[model samples]
Target chain A: MLRKLFKFHGGVKPQTNKTESTTQPIAQVPLPDRLVIPLHQAVGGHPRPLVAPGDKVFKGQRIGGADGSLSSAVHASTSGIVHDVVPALMPHTSGLTTLSVIIEPDGEDRWGELDKVNYRRTPPDELRDFLRDAGVVGLGGAVFPSYAKLKPGKEGRLKTLVINGAECEPFITCDDLLMRERAADMLKGIVAMRHMLQAEEVLIGIEDNKPEAVAAVQAAIAASGQSGIEAVAIPTRYPAGGAKQLIRVLTGIEVPHGRRSTDFGVQCFNVGTAYSIYEALELGRPLISRVVTVAGNVDRPRNYEVLIGTPMDHVVRQSGARPDSDRYIMGGPMMGVRLPAFGVPVVKATNCILVGSPALFPPPPPEMPCIRCGECAKACPADLAPFEMYWFSRSKNFGKAQEYHLFDCIECGCCSFVCPSHIPLVDYFRFSKSEIWARERDKEASDAARDRFEFKNFRQEREKQEKAEKLAAKAAATREKVAAEGQAGTTSAAAETPDVAAKPAAPSAEDTKRALIAAAMEKARQQKAQVAPKNTEQLSTETQADIAAIEARRAAAATPPTPDA
Target chain B: MLTALLVMTAVALVLGALLGYASLKFKVEGDPLVEKIDAILPQTQCGQCGFPGCRPYATAIASGEADINQCPPGGEEGIRKLADLLGREFKSLSEEHGVEKPKSVAVIDENTCIGCTLCIQACPVDAIVGAAKQLHTVVAGECTGCELCVAPCPVDCIAMEPIVDTLDTWKWRYPVIQIKQAA
Candidate 1:
């Protein structure tokens, strides 16, 4: 059946330098000397490393345990001895390190026992947990754990399952190659996901640019005898592979900004993710390796099935990267981040390492002022006023940027690609978005601190009130006993006034407690001298002088007592 | 003329009673400006501002008894916000209170701790936990980097350490671009 597709608001078509990488089939890269797999490959909680240094681990053995329900577990890519679990550089623009398990391969790729589950008989929740522990995540560069998104829709099942084969990014053909070669396995996984989600229909949206992948998926669906699944070809556009954009095109449902597609009875997954699910459930294998494309500034561009944590330079060397190749980008040229160095590993989010040279990807021209050209707004795929948002962002007016729905920009680079003045509009939007998030986090922390401080005050006040009540009760009993002895009203009232009722006179208990505490503290201080920390005790002479000065100030502060202060 | 004077007196009496009743019915307690100022404070309870807690400092500021630059934990950004909020001129944070520093949390050297609950009692947010004569530890999440526990520890086991930025906590920096503006 011919499928009519919907168009998203605005998109730019960059040069699709994809044919060079798709010439050869996906090849397996030989094992490197060491692998450095980061524990945080997905979007949620960082997984806790389970394997320590000097531990023997097998291929498919879990190396990192899921930190929480939202997190995905990590597996050993191959049988090896763990060298260490330490912080190593990650493939991020910040060049920050994360806790990773470094392994030295023993040349034996031994697999651990795998538990295959029959999806038809298994519960959906159990299947999701299995997927989490198996490290099945979106392979279209997002790397969001698939288990979290597998949650049942509001109506108990999804209305449509949109499989994104729209690999619209230039020079990234890992998804296309996978669809062309392993379409049958992908269909099996997609069918299994359908069973788990209880979906009514599935639409495989591949860009018309990859006709082979589209035809292959259509043939696979026909061969598998799947009734509800259909392969639909879509117009080739940059960022059409974005989950929201693909969903909008396939089902004509524009998921509201910042909301989940599942909320609207639709769920989307990358085609490679479906293949991994099929391998995990049917073959009893865990996610350890994926097909990554090594393209740009290389003599021979090709796709390789590389183990997670394999260094990027190792793959680049195989692809014959020229000596002039200066940098590597981890994804499409439009949306990928520039890798700080080559030693960073191929991670779950890595789909392509577009090696860059001054010749291949020239530096952008110096920026000129925006002339109210409206070109950026015309190319924004998310339908945002990019120039206005950029203006507000550059001025550090994050509130105004947010008012323009800055979060929906998706950092797609369409605006920058189309800007005649060579403005990096998306970078401004990213800055504003990060600033907003940072402010929100700061506000949350301050709010929490305020709550804790108020609670502490309330507790102290209540304790004081309770102490006064107890003392008053004791004094009342004494008054009654004296009255019984016929020494009534006036004397007892005077005694009570001097003791229980007056705030100043009631500190007898406080005085005794303080005395006891002071004695105990003196003893602790003496004992503390023996174990005093070197850092705090042997302070530099400057710090010592500062401390002495502070001490004198503190002594002066004691002269005139201020309430609570 | 006598009847007109009686009618005017009665009207005045009724209006006076209504005004008195309205005052009694809707009497507001506590200064709301103090609450707004308190909300702007960092809630560190560090006493670096010469007040016991954020609320007292806020009260002082609201009553014109304290300057707006007394809080160091809130830093210059916070001062700017306060200035904008109160229509006051922005002032550099007063060094008398303390110099602004990066956010940090207290870490207790468990080996050196002598089980005196001084730090616990000194904690304004009660973020420190331990029984007297037992080891005391700070609940790092709730410690608020107030530094109040560091000074009062009889054993001097507490030290303030700045939080490290990891890949997860790392953020995209402001983009650097040189623009040639002719307008």
Candidate 2:
């Protein structure tokens, strides 16, 4: 059936460049001598290493335990002996190192105990936990943990489930080939996901450009006899495969940033993620390998079922990488980051290892100033003024850039592709977005510091106040004791010497104290009056000023009463 | 005409009096300016500004008792923010107090610590943990690198280690492309 599709704003039509890899079927790569798997392969917290050096790990064994629900577990691709967990260079644009586990494959190909559950029989929460342990994550480049997004919305049931198989980016055909060949397996996973969401309707939206994948899904749905599940064809457009855009096309419901599609009675997942869900729930197998496409600057561009932590150079070599290939990109050219080097191991987010050569992907023409041609704004899929944000971002005016919603940009390279000035508009947006995040982190740290400092000051003040109050109470008790003793002494004196008692209490502590203070004050006052004037009379004006300053400081100190007083 | 003008003035005076009463009834006390200034100051509480803490220094700045350049930890960028907030000209950092350095946290040499509680007592944020005559350690995330603990440690055990860039902290640099040069 033909479904009415909604259009997302401002997408560019770049060459698909996907036919080169999709023509071939997915093949497996031989296990390398070693693997360096980073613990942080997803969006959330890094998983804790579950194995230590000198430990034997079985195939599909959990090597890194998920930190929480937001983090997915990590498994050893094949049976191996743990070599050491150390900081190794990661596949990020920053070229920084993170904690990774190194393993030397023993070639045993052994499986440890499996923890598989019936996806339908188990409760939803328990099933989600199982998937998390199985290391099922979105393989559509976002690498979000799939289990975290599996729940129903506030309505307690989903209205529609959208399975993403668009593969809209140029030169990335991993999902396309996966859907074309493994449609039945993906259908099983889709059914499990539908059960988890309890969705009323299921629609698998594949780009019309890939008629083969669409036909395969339709055939699988028909064979399964699931009338509720339908495959819909979406128009071929750049970024049409984005979760929000795909949801909009399938259901005509626009899901904004900071909002879940489930809230709008719909949720979406990548076809690869659904396939992993099937393998995890049905076959009792954990996710350890994925389909990665090696394209661009390679003699034989193809797709391979690459193991996690298999080095990129090793995979590119399998595809006959040309000598001119100077740079390696991690994902599709549109949104993929340039790998620091080819040596960084393929992570969960590696959908394509796009090798770049100067001949195939020339250095960008030197950037000319933006012409205000409005071409970038027209190509921006997020409906933002890319030129206006470009000005703010270039000027380091992050506040203004935020006002323009700079983060809404998905960095799909659509604007940069369409820009007449060749400004590398996407790079500016990335820089601005990172700067904003860094500033926010600094702000949080400073706020935390302020809270701690204020709390410490408050604590110290309270302690001082408590000590002062205790001293005051003690002094009051002593004053009462002295008063009682003085009264008795005054009576005894009065009784013994009538003349002295008639005048005043003599030889009492109170009387003596009062007399000493009064006499001391009188003497000091007289000496001050006598000596102050004499000293000032001979002193220079500068000395007099110094005296006045000292007097002011003394006055300031004298205002607060002493605890003893 | 005179009677009409007199009645108009009477009504205006009555409304003015009512507005004044309302303002007094609902007026907020205390200088919010001090709070605004305090929010701009980094709360390291190193006392390099000759004040007890950041709050006291903020209060002094708000009242014009202290200059805006005294905080070295805040650096020139912070001074710019302060100048923008207070509508003053940006001045160079006051050198007599200290110089701005990279963000760092203190690390304690446990071998040389001698179980002294000096660093623990010196930490303004209580980032240091351990009781008297025990092994003291600094919580890296909570530390502000104020360097107050360094001087107080008799064994000279505490050292400030500058934070290095990691995947989590790395940022994209501004683009520098030359189109004309390429031509």
Candidate 3:
């Protein structure tokens, strides 16, 4: 059957250096003295370390448990004693370190207990959990947990399953070699995934440049006698291997921004991921090793099936990298980041270790001002306005950059690869994205603070009002009690003497005033009597007569003076 | 002329009555201006703005009783917001209130805590949780870092710790310019 293919917008075809690596078969590297596996190999929450320091662990035993539903577990690559669980350098553009479990290999390489379950008999959800425990994730540079992609969407079942074998990036041929050597195992994994997703059709899309891979996958499909699986050759284009691009090519579906491809009844997985799933289910193996392509400036470039935590320096030394190779990149030239140091451990996302020299990757030319050339826009795979976004980002105008759909850029480096000005366009986009995320976090914190403050104010006001209300209530009660006591006193007085109550209702104002005046006059008279000559009785008789004579004279003088006035 | 004067007088009377009825029918009830002002003030409720709380400060601002710069917790950015909202001139936060500091949360030294409920009673936000004569701890999530609880602690066990930046909160710094060696 002829499968219809669709074209996506804006792609660049760089010189393909994939032939050097594919010239040799995938080789297996011996276990190093130690392994330093990072707990966060997939694109989700970091897994929690299960093996503590000084604990002996067996090969295939879980070293880290899945942190959440979206995370994948990590397993011991070889039988060893855990030396330490500490933060170690990881292969990231930011040159940051993550929590890693370092194990000193015991040189035994013994296998642990294996429990192989029939995936067909197992429920779909349980199968997904099994794959998660197996630490299966997308091996196509994304490292997204594979079980997440296996679950069906609201439509209840996936209509189409896409197997991306399009090893489209230059100097990265891990997937190509994977398809050539392990096509049957990949097909088995695909069958298992199809069973889990209940997908109707499986489309394996490989770029036409990798004719051998396409042929091998075709032969595998024929040998398996799978009616629904079809191996189709897509055109060779940079980033044609991007999940969305390959999905569009095979299914003729454009996955809109912010919506998953499963929404269109289509789901995509890497061929390497499919192989890992097969190994995990059929052999009861946990993912501890992957095929890594070592190329660029090395005397002999090839793909090696390297353990997950092998140091990059060890891999480079094994690859016979030239003395003049000054830098190392972890992906294709178009989208790879320079290694901070060569000793960082290999992560699940490390597909290609491109050794850099002055000859192969010359330092980028001095950046010139943008000449308003539309080449970047023409080469943008997502069809974004790179120059406009660059302008806004350069000026730190994040809002305007967001208006131009800055986050839609996948940072595929297509625009940067084709720019005449030699501007690092993707770097700008990354900066804008990180800035936006930081601003969002700040806004969230501020919002939380504001909420707490507002609640505090509200509570304080309520408590104050409550205190005032209680005081008012207490005052009102006291007044009521006092009035009741006064009423009781009046009632008791009336009950004791009815005649007293009838005496002009206790006394009128004039009568009370007259009585008060009469009492005051009588008290005054008594006071004058006491002050008069009461002590004179005890005095001598002559003294008393003299006192009387003085009083009589004073009285006569007073009477005459009053008459004259 | 007399008929014209009578007609104009009747028209004026009818319009006046209609206007009076409309005023009664469409009178706005609440003080929306105060709410608008309150929305702009950082609701710290620290009482540094001389008012008892944010709402009261907002009310004072809306009524032109308080200056827009009096809220130190609101800081300069908050004052700008209020200025923009009220169409007033922007001014620096008043130094009399307090100096603006980084967001912090209160932590209690449990060992030294005297179990005196003074800190709990001092906390304006009720963020402290404990009973009388019991070790009180601040609910860190709810603490506004107002620093009101620190002074009233008899043992001086409460400390205001500034929130630290972690990997999740780390912002991307500007990329340093790489100078290429002349080859």
Candidate 4:
């Protein structure tokens, strides 16, 4: 057991409402009539749907293939027929819908062909590809593609693989129960990842609060004969589950800004992610179902092996939520999003579903002016000046807020939890970030429009200048020819012959060439301005050689016959 | 007398040398973490907490310049985190800083809005953009709902509305627990 040395910024010990639902083993929720499986379950781009409409899919069958390097494939959670590939309800706070494979379950949970690949002999890159194909992602709050994090940096110095057991978020014990029950499987997952990453050390950092979990993990590690794996118990604190915080606590390294821990020769994976990795590698199972903790003011607080995209209302109903339930939150209370309605599906990021009455976490205290007591500054865990952020956020100074590192605030609710004024500090920061992002998007759009306009204007101006120059040169050439004809004692009628014969054709051709040049220049301006141009039509190219030749011949020939000046 | 004077001078110089060496060796390098900690502060120029701005407040928090409870904008979460970061005892957000409210962004009712650009001038973040005497519109996404614009609006077209949580805008809210399920 190791004690935490570097004190983090701010946190609060909220009422540990964890025991209410964890007494019973994980229960399997009854299958819903329709399963709306999202194509983009894990972070990154949406997977390409493999099974079209009306295609029959078995339980654990791949229905969507990975579309990008940073995406995961989508699988059928149960044996069902594809009802429709439509924009279905997703478990998101934004309330925006995403494409989902709506399947009407046949009630028979029959699995598809299991590809039992011998992962031991398989290359690490191949194993990673297999996992990605199987649609595995971090079961932690972040549903980032797991395989993406597996690859080492450019140096390929993979040293330690830390299994995060820090269920620091109050009311989340899904990982704990999983460790207690399926620790050996979790170990297998760890070993699989270790082999793939070629990590020398595997450390499972569990909170000391869960002694049972620690013991279970330790026993599992021992039974697996894994000398490389060590279960290290650390002090339980809020945000301990944070990857950066856990990495700091375990190895004493801060994940530098905008870089993954893998960059610094350390790879951190959630215990749940490790377990999923095991299932994918050994059991040939895709990430179809996961253990979700259903707790809070519900009648039954228990963990359930729920299908992905199972609506919160279904889970709440199964848990016997109170009749007058005012709020249903997905994930731990400290940072869980409140569902506007219970219809939001269970996403990969969901760890817990909290159904609570007003009495449990009372509505925050009535708005009060800040007392200038310097309390919020004392409570922030990210070392942020919550008070200052609040002022800037309130004053609508998003730039100032960002300069204060508004993006760094994890929205842990610790500041709001401890505010004497009962101020919802996280809300303000969230608002500020949203505003800043909005402004950035607006500025980008406007900048693009302005660039286009400026480019168009420049092309037009250049075309006008070039056209004027050409017309002047043509007129000058005609006058010089006329003068030369008169000086050479030829008839004025002879000089007029060429001008009369070629005038219409020449002007028309010149006009067309000028127009083309103008168009090309406009397009070139666009191409130059764009970050990435998909086609060449946007580029405006001018024929410089022809114009240069014309000018050069005219300058040298004086009044003698010049070729098409 | 010469010997005594030499001995006294030698002792004085030796003592001075020792003191200077001690000062150089043990000149406490103030906490290296203060600047980073300060960088996280909300740089709201509004001195509602009595500090000139966010950095001063951060310095006060880090170097014990001011109490962590002073900022109203930071609220409870800010105070607790600061305490954790600075290794200070966690106190509630100062009552004087102001109560936390549902985040609202400014919205301009285009129909009701006159060409007055007072709200534009009042916005600290430059969230509002419109020419003087031109029809003004509130960029809902950019408006932080600080309410500074609300006060400055001559026609009272600007209203602070709670940011509608849409699917894209919705982030996973941290879950509150009643029991710790042992993993």
Candidate 5:
């Protein structure tokens, strides 16, 4: 029976370049001398380190524990001695470093204790916790923690569960190969997921181009004899594998901005995530390795089941890449980031390592100013007005850009792929998003400072008011005491003489001022007396005679003035 | 005409009574202008604005008693924000208060500290944490770098250190024009 499929708004068909890697079966690469695993493998908080340096770790021992609900734990790829936990370069477009744990493989490949739980007997919440501890996350580019998506929706039960096998990005075929080889394991994982979500049905959406994967999954479903679990081949497009896009293609439901698919009684997960879930519950294994497609500028391109934290340089060399390869990208050409260095680790999210040469991938042409072309808008999968957002982002008017729903853009590179003017539209959008986030962080800091400052001010004012009120009350009490004493004195005086009682209660202002002036004069007089003529007492006789002569002349002059008056 | 005039007076009286009652029922309080001004002022409460605190300074600015440039803790950016809020021309920060400097927090050298309470009394925000005649330490998070306690310390143990940016506080800088190098 044919099921009706739905189409998304806009997409561009880039050359797949997947045949080079898909011709051969998936191979395994030898372990390196060391592995550098970054604590932050998922999209949320960085996991805390569990095993410190110099500790013995097994091949599948939990090394990094999940920080919170939004984070996923990380396990050791192989048995080794913990080398050092330090800051090392990560596979990111920003070329930044984060906390990473280095391990020296002991070559023993020892396995730790494993406890496989029966899914039928385990509760849903406990199973989700088990998956989280097993380090299960979406391997379809986003790498979101899988346990977070297994919960029921607001309606108390999921209506449909869409398993994404749509390897739509060009030059990425790891998902296709995974489904073809391990379709039964993938099916078992889907059944567990369906049981956990209690969904009415399960729809595995695969792109039509991968006919082999589709057939294998169909066979797995038939062998299992599961009801309500069907395979639906979707149209091959650039981003049909996007969670929202795949959800739409499978269920014909359009998830709006700021709303989740669960709100509509649906949830989507990558097929690789389901396979990891199955491995965790069935084999009691943690996510230690994944199938990574190594292509581009390599003589022998193929997919390898590479261990997590294996350096990208070793993987590229094993794939027979030429020494002249100028750059390396971590994902497909459409949404991949240029790796800063090949020494960065192969994280859980790394699905492809595309070696780049000048001939294979040339530098883009000089960016030209936008000419108000509507090409980008038409190619935008989210149906956003890319041109308007571009104008605002260029001017740094993020407020206006947000009004045009800038956050809704998935940064799929479709707009940049179709722009006539060769404008790097996605770069501008990324820049805008980071800038907005930075500004929001700054606003929060300022607001906190303001609150603290305001509280300080309020506290000071209350203290001052309390102090003033206390002083006022004390002054009132003192005045009352003084008045009562004065009243008692008057009554006693009246007993002695009535006339003395008729006098005023306090001294007049004139008398007080006169007395104060007199006291000041007396103080001045006392101070003058205290200062005696020091050297005059020891003067010689000659000096005293000379002083007497000068005094006599002064007295004669004063006498003449007195006679004239 | 007389009857119509009496009827009009009666209606006016009833409406006036209703309006008076509504005014008393829904009385709006608080000065929104002061709140707006306070939001613009960096709330250092350093008393650099000649007022007791940021609230008083905001009130003074709103009432036209204080200039926007009187806040040194806010610096020139603060003046610009205040000017924009009040529709006044921006001016350089007033030197009477102090010169603008990078944000700093006070740190007391515990070994050199003599357990004197002078610094504690001088602190405006009471950011110092200690007891009388006991070793006092500055709460780095709460210290606004007012430098009021610096002069009061007899041992001169308090040091104003500039805040350092770490990875958590780091942000992506604005894009710079890149000139391609010769390959």
Candidate 6:
């Protein structure tokens, strides 16, 4: 029911190309003979293997345990024999391999014992642990741990829990179809999350483009007769599914930078995530499988609730992907990743797999030089000066590039899409960010080295100072004894200038003390001077301001040349 | 007063004319060479070329300061781009710009690192962590993988390992060609 306001900054209206697949219902694909399950499927630390090689694992059994707080556990998608625990090629931009558990599935899909919990009466902590065990994470492409995201802060005050039904990415309508068909299950999941967060209200934001899905969710809400839960339809926009963007569109409150939406009295979960959560908590099912959209250039483009760790080739073949059509993408065209080959497995984050020929969606245009047309700048949603970033990026002046608010860029690919030159603007930004991080890493290492050197120097100085103090004290005692002897001799034979004899010894201790103080002062000065450059954090801050000033000057200086029109 | 004003105006006009003429006469040929040089740079925004982006880097290359081998994203194509920009012969992607490894972030093997924090301090982007004698970790989002940490690691725990390529990291490589075939 929220009215959309505020014109969003630079974006291109790419062809939705979704109708080709949205009409078709999800179809099942035959399981693969071999499944290569990468340990780090979701966005966190890689899961460590709980079962060694040669272990007989049942379908949906926990084979890989959670490795870190940010990671999730992995379950066997099919009953299989663990063939090997070794490095396997994963589907990523890096094209590198990591540790994976390869399972050679037995003919039968034998089920494992399920661990269902009664959420109505169960404690939230126990439910959280249960969800973790189920490997329930955000199925909205980010693959973030759902339990970790639902955990409330120390203040324990959570306001609105926003269910993100806004599947803005084009050609990926699994969420849309799910809501239309499985609205009841999706709603049940929402209630479970509501209890988990102790949130006051539950707001479901569905994009108006999916009118049927919205109507279905509304009917479901009405049937449940749920209080404090309402479905609000938002306008269709690219990246409208982003937590911050969706929050602003629905609630009119911007999620501040580097802060979670939860900080602003709001929490977000995808429609798919809700369903997954429902299955995990109610059905006692672990996230051993997911819904995938196999669309584009295939004879039949449809959604499938396939078992996780299924190979791409098998899924595509089942979906009727033509053999002549080899180009395959893992997500939506706007921001989806392209796999090098079809051998990669379908991981948790993968929602849409496109197998297309050149005719349906043509390859990107040949890139030309950025002519400073300012179209990219117009397209940047972050209000950054992309042309200048282009300039600085071209120059390898990362410090200045950052000064221009490079980090603020969400890498939405709008600039690249809108560029007259077909410039890969996002690529430049990614490179700069990577370079900045690398430099930061290097500086940290050097600082650590310097600290060790300084600590050693400090220790050495302290040791010298202690040694000199001990020697001086010993000399003083010797002098005191000599004085006593001289006094006794004077009584006996009227001898000696005792004061003159002790004068040389007295100044030595005082001189040594003065020398130690000088050394300490020099050390302090060195430390201060050396520490100045090491404070690289300030470099980002100062450069940011300088970039702002440069942008201001550019705005004032630039007057558009009279067009020939 | 009228005659004096007339004389002043005449002299000013003559001086202005002379100055304008001299300005043009002394002006060195402002070069279009930089643009041509920039055209040769591998347009991949990977800054291994040491320049922020391709154009400014092209300018430096035109001036004959930057090495040709620095671009990894451009790989051979970028070297060719740089070569085209400089009107120089193309060469292989420099091994030092780092091999055409799939893009990866540096991960610190925390256990082996001596907490010397050398990698942390050496990071120009401040991506590494751990205090004196404490374990240091890389903020993955902030790491650039310039290989600046590799040399600084006293214990050699910091590795320039490529991020395991997942469907997430994969991007459609520039297609060999773009032509519309009627479906």
Q: Highest DockQ: which candidate? A: 1
Highest-scoring model, lDDT: 1
Enumerate residue pairs that collide in model 5: none
* Predicted structure 1: lDDT: 0.88
Each candidate's root-mean-square deviation in Å?
A: 7.2, 13.3, 22.4, 22.3, 15.9, 16.9
Give the C-alpha miss distance for residue B66 in model 4, angstroms: 50
Q: Write the per-residue lDDT of candidate 1 for residues B124-159, one digit (tens) a residue.
A: 788999998999999887888877666567777899
Residue ranges of candidate 1 with Cα displaced over 4 Å: A483-565, B1-30, B180-183
Per-model C-alpha lDDT, please? 0.88, 0.86, 0.84, 0.75, 0.83, 0.74
lDDT of 5 by residue, A421-499 (tens): 7778888888888889876865665566567655654675576556556655665565567667874434353343322
Evaluate candidate 4 by giving its C-alpha RMSD to the native, one decimal.
22.3
TM-score, every prediction: 0.88, 0.85, 0.77, 0.65, 0.77, 0.65
Candidate scoring better on TM-score of 2 and 3: 2
Winner on lDDT between 3 and 4 is: 3
TM-score of 2: 0.85
lDDT of 3 by residue, B1-183 (tens): 999999999999999999999999998887999978876766555666766567778899988899999877678988988999989899988876656778789999999998888767566567799998788889886777766676566677888899765445545555333435322
Interface RMSD of each: 6.4, 14.0, 22.2, 19.6, 14.0, 15.1
Clashing pairs in 3: none
| Stretches > 4 Å off in candidate 3 | A470-565, B1-167, B175-183
Residue B18 lDDT, candidate 6, scale 0-100: 100
Clashes of 6: 64
Model 1 chain B lDDT-worst window of ten: B174-183
Q: Pull out the clashing pairs in model 1.
A: none
Candidate 4 global lDDT: 0.75
Write the residue-wise lDDT of candidate 3 on A185-299 in tens digits. 9999999999888899999999999999999999999999999999999999988998889998888898978998888999999999999999999999989889999999998
CA displacement after TM-score superposition, residue B179 of candidate 5 (Å): 11
The CAPRI class of candidate 3 is incorrect
